[model samples]
Target: MSNFKITDIVGVIPALITPFDENENFDEGRMRNVVDFLIEEGVHGFYLTGSTGEGFLMTPDERKKVVKVVVDQVNGRVPVIAHIGAISTKISIDLAKDAYETGVDAISSVPPFYWKFKDNNIFKYYEDLSGSTPLPMIVYNVPLAGLFGFDFIKRLSTIENVKGIKYTAYTHQDIHKAKAQIGKDFMVYSGADEMAVSGLFNEADGIIGSFYSMLADVYVDIYNNIKAGEFSKAQIKQKIAVDIIEASLKYDYYAVIKAAMKWMGFDGGYVRRPFNNLSSCEEEKVKDEFRKIRDRYGVEDIRVLKSI
Candidate 1:
């Protein structure tokens, strides 16, 4: 059985961006660097192969490789929650087993999407997948998938080993209600990057989002400030984060994130195919905007941008 309790997965957990090579291949070396960089920046845990990681774009084997590399690199320094959600129960089960063997602290899955499965079917999916491995199970409640509701979450929570929910919707009210109804033992990580401050104030156990991968220290500060009752300080950081996100949203989200990381001196390569890449001119514009945001917000000067 997994030694990690639900509480161990709390705090600023980044839904990591999967690094790729020019040929769109998974780059192990770059992946390790991303992992090490985030750990050094003080993130509490990692959620691998999720939407931000382009989990659905890669083959199952590629996903497994990514998880193995991260788990090996992490070396138990912090908890690693592998996103093994697939449309098929068998596939998710297989991935969960592999995640257990690879030593992840927990496993999470987006309820099977693409088909309009009923609540019962969804519950069955969680039941089989969570029971397949001893690792703590975190249900990914992404409303965009159209399968999420508080009632569904409560039902899933009853499953053996199902311990938490990565609540990715914008409804902070649901987060507050879940905490009150589900009890503190059920971990509810706020998965909306733009709402980090609101989520925490509403009683989310922690924050997990795509932006956290790019701005780990900033979000870490936000979490710390809130915990310390420094609401004003946390709001300042959250505003900076919002500004960055607004700028990036003007371009292809994944492409611009990779581009920004490159400008920061960490070349995470490009977003994989089926996702558009930023043109040369577009890349430069994004770089300029990002630099301005960084300077305006006084984002820490640890990156190579200071020298540039």
Candidate 2:
């Protein structure tokens, strides 16, 4: 049998932020705490080493260390989806294999960037990575990366081990089109934190996002409240989440979140250099706004993951 398809595990999958210590080294202690915090905050699992985690910024070795820290902490309590995209297929394959050996539940990869490739090249990329390990692979489609569109996804999704997609942002129509093409059992994870409600409403099985670094419960509550048929509550929470995203963008996004993690006592450490730190000026404004997001979403300071 193929490794577990994503539907077997779903919801509030946070693309984790990489924690860095003063030396610009990966901070294992802080990384573990962040994983624990998300698990406790009702996040179902982790989507590691993505844009939020600065996966693109890290060396291959650093990426492996980050994945190891998370898998080691998660143990069996939650599923972990490791993102292994890099400039080379070899590095991506090695990372996918390493994550599988280290005990991650699944893996996803963004389409290769920098050197734009034809559909055939994207096809081969997924073919190679999925074949590299039995782990169910989700093709990450981030147009912002300038590497993806529907044709590429349709081609990649056919790989036997390729189970689904984690699309950066798509209209309900776009998802509908994908739904028709990918067919049953191939999960579609929503990438736009802003579009979670609409995606889940249209039947997306899960979510993979950078915003979940701080807004874990907001994402969860929106889904739970909707499934519970509490539409009013769900909409209110989603609005709060969007507001948080807006405020987060206003501040330095990573800086605001690293600061939030520290405030919550999770030791989220700091965003590595080249990403820069969130300015103290924006930080002051964001804290107040963040409090609003927390209150609006009905996420308690201490929470637990709902049984998936």
Q: Number of the top candidate by lDDT?
A: 1
Clashing pairs in 2: 42-305
* Each prediction's whole-model lDDT (CA): 0.86, 0.78
Residue-by-residue lDDT tens digits, candidate 2, 1-308: 12344677788888899989877789898888888888988888888888889888899888988887787788778888899997689999999888888878788888777886777887888899999988899888787666466776677777888988887776655666777777867788888888888887877887777778777877788878878988888787777677877877875587777777776667678778787776666666677666665666655532211110
lDDT of 1 by residue, 1-308 (tens): 34466787789999999998889999999899888988998999999998999999998899999999998898888898999999999989999999899989999999899999988899999999988988889998887677477787887889999988898888889888887897878888999899999999999989999888777778999999999999999999889888879988997788877776776667667899899889999977877876797788776643423423
Weakest 10 consecutive residues of candidate 1 by summed lDDT: 299-308
Model 2 ranges off by over 4 Å: 1-5, 288-308
Worst 10 residues of 2 by lDDT: 299-308
- Give the CA lDDT, 0 to 100, for residue 290 in model 1: 69
Model 2, residue 307: C-alpha shift (Å): 26
User: lDDT score, residue 266, model 1?
Assistant: 72
